[model samples]
Target: MPARPPERTAADLLTTFGAAPHQTPRQPPTSAKRGRVNRPTAPLRGHARPGHGWSPVLAPLPVYQASTREIGGLFPLLVASPMPAVGARIGYDVQSGGAFYCHPVEWVLRNGLATNPNIAMFGEPGRGKSSTVVAFALRMLNFGVRTLISGDVKGEYTPVVRALGATPIELGAGNHARVNALDLGPLTARWDTWTVRRQRDELSSVLGRWVQLLAALAESQRHPPSVSDEAALAAVLRRLVGASDGYTRLRPITIPDVHRELASPDPQLWRDLRYESRHDFLHQLRPMTDALANLISGALAGMFDAPTTVAIDWDAPVQSMDLSRLRSRGDTAVAVALTCLGAWSSLATGLRDDGDIRIVVRDECWRQLRLGPRAVAAIDAELRLSRLEKIIQILVLHKLSDLYSVGATGSQAVAIAKDLIALCSTRVLFGQSTRVADDLADALALTGPEHQRLTGPVNERRGRALWKTENHPAHLVQTVLSSFEKRLFDTNAQLRPTAGRGGGVGRSRG
Candidate 1:
């Protein structure tokens, strides 16, 4: 059926509601002139679109309630000034979207912000701490800065030293490389500038460093050095650098020579002590002699007993002593080697007046403090004098707690450790376990926000760390490395297990 010619549908009526009720097709607006299409136009101030013909509307716009989304908002409300561009490009600033540069010595010296140019780094194993140091050192070389690593506990820095065309002296039992404890090469220039009193004081200072090492050795063996032992050591050192014709005779001294002098004391020196005092002094000095012997002729023999096989060229951009072998021998051997290296490095830097920067890194710093308070004092003194020497010292370890672990909670050892940590003007900390974070928060004097950051998800970013400088807020930085650096500074290549030579691990393919 036609159904009354299909009554007008509701859809059809609704479709034409915006137009005339008669439902006639709307015609496009046209100009009064024939064949000319018309369009609405407005005055504009911006460049016009090429085709679409969109123009700015010059009309009074109505204002509406403003909201964050409507105002083009962002999430994190970060406000930080980028580190000045005065040093090596290490990474990017997370807060300010700027490049970050770092040079511990340069920054401190230039800004006069810190009295000590020493740096302290704490990170868990496998957190890229070593790599950051290696990269920083390599970059520093470009600026003519020289670096000396006093102790490479894991031999991790050998590749970097070699890559830079510098030789790494491997010191341990049976290694041909030997560093004469008294090689004057490091002290020659220093002695030249010294007056009689200064020379005596300098030599005495060296003797004191040696005594610290010996005492550390004794402490490790549960036999702390007695006062008599220390006095005897001072006396022996004075005699070793004895006077010749009213002038102090300076000669190349070996550890063996020092050992010999101790074993057979001068009759006049013995005459000064009472019978009981002499016996006690001898008894105390015996252990020191044994420590010297062990380092000179026992397990660590030949490493530092003779003249240095190869001179440490201060002109070289990088120098590192690979103490991995000695580290394997136990903490005692490492302590002794570290002591010698520290003394030598300090004297060497003192000898130079080039005004160029020098860096000394002591990885696994806790091992050196095991020798008790004397060693700690020696290191503290070195750190304090670093500014005058133009030397920047870096101490790298796992956690801040390591420093306090040397002695009882309230002992002088702990106090010295704390002082040593306090000397660092720049501090870098990687992600730590919750417990370590709590300990460090107190030790580092971290703010509430900093503590939360360290213990929160921000800490989960691998290779990312919080860097703090004097009177500055901590920065969360991710270290950047080039492909070459990634390979050159890899410390775990040897440690990682790989497939067998034939490719599979289960069985050998013969």
Candidate 2:
């Protein structure tokens, strides 16, 4: 062991470290100390003392108590977590800064995020509404879901369809393709095997659709058929399909065939319609017959009056009807074409062997609404039955006012059109002018912040839309398109001469 080191005192340690030991002052007398008052020590270095000239007292802040709802208005970033990372990666959620995904069908079935898979989109032209739809459709193809544009009035979807390696069915003056409005499609393919009850239900559904289509066509001509006309039409359809006497199998029919039968109906037809005589039947259904004749010979002649000339490949990823050729014929011609094509597409899609999901894009659907209340009813039926059909119906329009324009105020057509908004579980609102804000706010039940978002400059940015699912927090989405998608979905080819050729990288934000 080493020799013990000497214990160091405080003074010895301080002196060894080159410092002097602190010294204490002499104590005062007890009498003197009693008279002297103790004072607070000087303030710490670099700190101001309260009540000193350098520091001023501050009043107490009122205790702030606010609900999360009120606080969210001030800080929009405090939003619920984004939707699960499923479906197509559309873009990013503006509020939460997370990737946004949207697949109406998946959202409904998988997560119960919505009550239905139907979506209604409203946006001004050139706001990337079509682009968003095309992007969604293109992405959905990866999931094995097909897309069907029943009627492309502007021919905007032609490139997309062709890009997907499918020829778009072109119908117009110069085009040779034709679609029969009354084609039963595959509705009766397995009729012989189905039970009698199933047959009855199938026939009733088929006949109901035909009646609705005929009524819509007649209404389009400004001569809405009466209840008797509809009854007569149903009787004629049942007879034409050979279901009048409870036949097991049904045959496909055409508009011309129906027109011919109505023009010269047999006694059984009138009797089945419950009319006393042929003359009474003929007089009572003259308006409907004339409407049919007009449809056969008018602008729609040779297009929808004969058998369908185009063969649709059900396995294809995309199928679109290019009605742009008829766009020159006027909105009425295009609307009439849409109504017929809608019915035909419903049947064609129903004929699929595999009950796979499909996205049915109804662009410019407002034109069909302008036809009449019956036409509106046809669309309403489609929306209501989308879930049952395993289809995601996307109805695109310019604005909510387009629905109001279906008829006069307080009219049945207008009411039906307005109800169309409620039928869709998801509503996508793109950029719109301030003029349409009130209608949008009312139609969508938008909150104050949502209304401001729509009317604000945020929406002015193309591809930026507010996606509102049923009772869910609205998602502000910025639809992002890849370089290839930009070229394929370019709808401004005519507007820009260099659009079709290799051009600058296209972003929907433009």
Candidate 3:
């Protein structure tokens, strides 16, 4: 398709609006107050591209007029009569003012599968990463926004569940809740949820990696262990197990665990494998039990299949997931707990009918998205729900490098997301200042003091930030803070890991 004509210039815009370019005198809505509205000099008066006139055919949608400049340095993609970001066009709102993102109408109407397909936020501790974003999602929800919160960190979202009156659907707790992986039971009541042909089609392709991985684990456990021993064992296991049963969340088969399982029942098979060196490696891999757990929970979250409608009782307070217990736990264990939380969040958001479901997939979420083997890929793809499913993921991660350590391959993490919110768009240099501010000022295509004014000041204060919009250079904006910021990741303070099943492990919970 041909491109739309070049966007209109400022002068062309002004002249098009006619003599009173600031006040076009549009018909005010019934809700409009006489003094509150800013009558633009004139309607958008720019000529269309070479082919058209008046209403620029190529222009994106618009936002509503605002009483005052609310938030700053955000893309005012959708425009409105003299309003940068007003009303539903609003995005972030701090005490100082409100900022607009895309027009709500456009958002409601558009496919939402644009270049930036996922929502993202990043900040150092205490910058209100989850808390602030939760409230933001709620505000959108109250206005009947369609979204879902697949929470990566559960504790950060309790405030959100409460503020929105969303019910707590905890596994092993709520009546409606079932403590199982992927919440798959609810996907289809009947046994044949998937067609026979579909299942068969997926068998050879989808189950390949999963079966191989499990087989490798079993092979590593043999006693005499020839170099080809483990491979031989894996071949045997693959011949016996089927995908449907093998891929079940309940069927956890880790590498070490596989060795342990093989060592039992079939003593000769275990002994013939000559697994001494591999056993030592297995012992060293003890700490990874938690990492395995994290992978499990993540894989599970990606498996939810249900009616996708959750009704909340406004009278009851929302219950947030308590991660207060995960502090002292091993880092990998912490990651696992978070995966459980994300699974729950995704499940909750996938089913809300009354409002948007804001699933905040933060912290180590890239782990699940990164693991691209068929089983895990299917999980991620399903949970990365489409518009038909009311789920909007707010992925939060610190340095982009962390995306590397995650289990999956390629740019699966970045490829899955839709939008990015670069917080405090700043730089560090002499005396703890940065050239990013200068670059931001220059990039708004600003030359004079105005750019300096917007990108000015580097404060140590929390909740205050700088950003840039399509129209101009980066600037500062104030926002509310979340409770967990500075308290969790950046600080030493931690939560004890939640108790796992079985009593043989720890003396007591931390």
lDDT of 3 at 134: 45
Error of 1 at 229 (Å): 1.7
lDDT of 2 by residue, 247-287 (tens): 75687788778888888999978887788899987888888
The 10 consecutive residues of candidate 1 with the worst lDDT sum are: 501-510
TM, every model: 0.78, 0.82, 0.45
lDDT, candidate 2, residue 387? 86
* Candidate 2 backbone clash number: 0
lDDT of 3 by residue, 382-408 (tens): 334543454444455433333333334
Give the TM-score (vs. native) of candidate 2. Answer: 0.82
Model 1 lDDT tens row, 203-245: 7666777666556655655666778777766666656666332
Q: Report, for every candidate in turn, its global Cα lDDT versus the true structure.
A: 0.71, 0.82, 0.37
Residue pairs with colliding backbones in model 2 are none
Answer with 1 or 3, whichever has the higher lDDT: 1
Alpha-carbon deviation at 17 in model 3, angstroms: 19
Q: List the candidates ranked by lDDT, beginning with the highest.
A: 2, 1, 3
Kindly give the stretch of ten consecutive residues in candidate 3 with the minimal lDDT sum: 423-432
Clashes of 3: 66
Candidate with maximal TM-score? 2
* Candidate achieving higher TM-score, 1 or 3: 1
